[model samples]
Target: MKYTDTELEKTLNELGKATYAGEVDVVDKVMNRLKEAENKEKFSIQKERKVRWTIGTMSLAAASVALLLFIGNSSSSQAQNENDGMAKFISEIYNRQSQADVVYYTPDYIDILLGIEGMDENI
Candidate 1:
């Protein structure tokens, strides 16, 4: 519905006279709620960043642990290879030649401590 100019002027004058004294309080309460919401949003953003950082750090630690474990396994194999000498094979030959004078060791006992012979020892 449309109002005449006089009615509009009268309405403006009544509003200027503060016929709604409680409206300012309502506006302040709404502004405070909006500020609280903004603060909560900022706090949530910070929390999300912390979670992302924690996840990234944990992943990095896990990857480092895995790499260290892999390196340890490789070094252990290399050490076993480096220790391969003539003793075990010589012992095996002597054991077969004189079963009592030398110990009658099993094929597995005579297996190389490092090489593929350990996997399936056939003397």
Candidate 2:
């Protein structure tokens, strides 16, 4: 629905002259209600912020704990590797023995050598 400029001006003038015959305190009541709604909206926003902060704090703490656990596990594994000198020595000896056996020993001689070395004791 399109209106000419004159029709639009006349409609606006009529609307401007309209009157309300309702309660005298209606404006004040509506203003009070609007103020109350604004206050509730502000409170809800504050509550949401508090909840977000709490979740963020919890997430940070969990991440910290996970990092600490990972570091502790890595440190322990490193320490174990550092203390494995005997195991490394035994591995080297076994590798050398195998190479020597391939070049010099029969199966029977290798069994004798294993008995003499007390392989169980090394383990």
Highest TM-score model number: 2
Please write out the lDDT profile of model 1 over residues 1-123, one tens digit for every residue: 899999999999988987654634478889999999999999999999999999999999999999999999999978776555455667656656576534455444455432557454444
lDDT of each: 0.76, 0.82
Off by over 4 Å in 1: 1-25, 81-123
- For candidate 2, the TM-score is 0.52
Give residue 79's error in model 2 in angstroms: 1.9
TM-score to true structure, per model: 0.47, 0.52
lDDT of the structure predicted as candidate 2: 0.82
Model 2 residue 22 CA deviation (Å) reads 5.2
Give Cα distance to truth, residue 98, candidate 2, Å. 14
> What's the CA error at residue 20 for candidate 2, in Å?
7.3
Cα misplacement distance, residue 26 of candidate 2 (Å): 2.0
